[model samples]
Target: MLYKVVSHMLEQEAVVEAQNSTQAKRKACRLWGVSPSDEWHGISTMQARKLTEKERRVAAVAIKHRNICLHTDEGGSTVSIRNTATALSVINQLIGTDTGYFG
Candidate 1:
């Protein structure tokens, strides 16, 4: 997707294609200055590590909402999540998501 990279100067922006928004931010940063934050989308960047094979599998995609569960191969059980943002943040940590303050 083509993500818009806007600097503090709003008027100073650039467009670039990337696998995800974070990648876009990185590319924008390379252009000179671009600060990336989860607040970019009014969201916070989630940090997560693999708990098992299934967690690994879950990390492969983006989960938009919370209150969802995902199963892994190593475990014969499922894990229930509470918050959507936290879960998504975890998933995002594995795969980049644009948590910027934008829509």
Candidate 2:
């Protein structure tokens, strides 16, 4: 199963595959180059929780579709428009021209 592990001490988080929260914490600590024992000392400040089915599915879809791009150089670095009509409406708005069909 997939777990979302957050390290308050390091101000970082990761999604890891583990059997349980304990294992998730351990794996997260290893990935972050921290000691798992530090949790006892209140140093690691790690938390682990399982991802829900919906969250998992959404994540998978987002990764597969790449609907949003952050880098300008990557081409299509914009939110994807689903259909031709919607795309035309957006283009018209950007150009300050309202086509009657979309308006």
Candidate 3:
């Protein structure tokens, strides 16, 4: 599962995959290059919470859309689609549902 960890002292946040909050905090600290001693000393006040299902879905859609936008043509050039309808169609296909906004 994905968890969001926030460091109140550093005013920073990170998303990590962990089994629980303790693991999430450890992963986030490692990602930020923070030492365990610093965390214990309250140098980087950290809190970890799991991401909701909706948030996870949104994140997945965003990643997939980014990959779609970065797709390249046969000539090694990036293909850009400027049509809103086409974009909506792609999004609907990725999420496996029609959101009704583009209907």
lDDT of each: 0.41, 0.56, 0.56
Tens-digit lDDT string for candidate 2 (1-103): 6667776667666666679988988877776677878754232477778776764554444444644333334444565656533432333233222322211
**Would you list the clashing residue pairs of candidate 3?**
none
lDDT of 1 at 40: 46
Query: Model 2, poorest ten-residue lDDT window?
Result: 94-103
Model 2: pairs clashing at backbone N, Cα or C within 3 Å:
none
List the candidates' TM-scores in order. Answer: 0.30, 0.54, 0.55
Whose TM-score is higher: candidate 1's or candidate 3's? 3
Q: How far is 67's C-alpha from truth in model 2 (Å)?
A: 10
- Whole-model lDDT, candidate 2? 0.56
* Per-residue accuracy of model 1 over 1-103 as CA lDDT, tens digit each: 4344555433344444467766766665655443445254211232212134444334323333333343445544334455544554444332333322212
Clashing residue pairs in all predictions, respectively, total 12, 0, 0
Model 3 lDDT vs. the true structure? Answer: 0.56
TM-score, candidate number 3: 0.55
What value does the lDDT take at residue 42 in candidate 2? 30
Predicted candidate 3 versus true structure: per-residue lDDT over 1-103, tens digit per residue: 7666777676666666679888878876776688756845232478877776775665455444543433224333233444533443344343323432211
